[model samples]
Target: MITDTIEKLVAKATQLVHLFNYCELCEQPIYQQVALCDHCVSLIPRFQLDSLSGDLLNRPEIYGLYSKCVFDHLIAISPYQYPMSDWLKQFKYLGRWQYQRLCCRVLNFHLNELLKLSDFCPPDIVMPVPIHINRWQHRGFNQTLPLARTVAKVFKVHCNADCLVRQNQTGSQAQASGQLRRKQLKNNFALLPNETSYETSNEVTGKRVKLEGMHVALVDDVVTTGATVSEISRLLKAANVAKVSVYCLALSL
Candidate 1:
């Protein structure tokens, strides 16, 4: 009980700090909870949008970066560069939690813009690409999970983290070649039995949620070779998921 109280207090304190926060980059007082000011947010480079379909992958340059594609759609905030690269490094490696909020806010902003398009279709369900349990223990959290929840909240869909499991851990793909990534990630991911249901907290339950023929959004922090999400997409397709949309923070090329 004491621990819970202390956590609550810390959370409340964090909220208050955000409520009166300054922009981390510009040093301007920010009235809202966002870590960056509006100007800084606008200054972040965007992945060019498809003029017709609103899918980033529909653009030739972005599409050509991947060796092969399995997911039907790709939505991303920016190309992996500059401020985004720096922020992601902090959030994923240095454990700076504030950058997570910054990334989520940027993603939410872009997703809202995409929703304005007439042809855009949101997924029925969303999930983050799973990290191995060993990595989870070392990292203490899967960075993509919060981003997945952000997408789910924006789309008003259930965020189900329990459905997919990463069966193995591979070496850093940041500097690895596409073929090597594909080789290492081969058969690295597996899905849990579809009968399992997850609570909002992602705890497992007896209540079954059907995934057959459902559209799924797979969220990830970055997509370099597309090997990881592609492998995961193959598993989802085998399970009869009708469509898999990839949502990511950045595309590395």
Candidate 2:
């Protein structure tokens, strides 16, 4: 009990430090409850959670960054090809936060098609697949995190960035088969031990993580073959998260 209290204090202190260090890029007060500014906040495309079903879901695409372009309950948006294509270079790599908002808005816009079916549901919490510690240390940020956090905030649900964490370093997935890629990423995450217990908190994925069933919405910046999300989803299922629905800003075409 004492240790948990101390950890919470430390986490709060760190968050405060980050908050103070964060300057309003536009001098607009930076009042985002998540990490976005008002400009980014206003740009998110409105989406209906119930519109993802179609012929595409039934037939599922077979290749090119998307083996299954559409899920019976999943809809995705990718403005351009990935691995830092021009569009992604501008929005994801160049800190063009507005484009992040636009991408998410588009994802939301297409949600109606998937949700029309009953088997799918929006994730209870939005969790970005965490970066390897080494890369996160080098890059200074996980490019996908801000957008994922923003998506969670929009739905007024909890975002569990810490619940599932990445521990191993890895090579990029640019030139691998889908099955080989998933094997490469297998066993990459485990439930984190430091935060508040899922049981006591008023968080999303409301089911108990270590003990009972949970349903989660896994978020990512872009998914290429989905090896990363599938690996983590497997880990979460081992930890007993009942359902793992995925959401992404873009799907490489």
Go through the candidates in order and give each one's C-alpha lDDT. 0.85, 0.57
**What's model 1's overall lDDT?**
0.85
Candidate 1, residues 73-168, lDDT tens digits: the string is 888789899889988999999889999999988888778878887888989899899999988899899999999999999988789988889888
The prediction achieving the highest lDDT against the true structure is 1
CA RMSD for every model? 7.2, 11.7
Error of 2 at 200 (Å): 7.4
What total of clashing residue pairs does each candidate reach?
0, 16
Q: Which stretches of candidate 1 lie over 4 Å from their true place?
A: 1-19, 50-52, 194-208
lDDT of 2 by residue, 1-253 (tens): 9999999999998887666522123344443322344464334432233332422233334232444322223334443353224445566556676555545544443443454567645556667778888977776677777667766765545676776677788767667877887677777767776541443245444555442365577787766677787777767666666776677766554
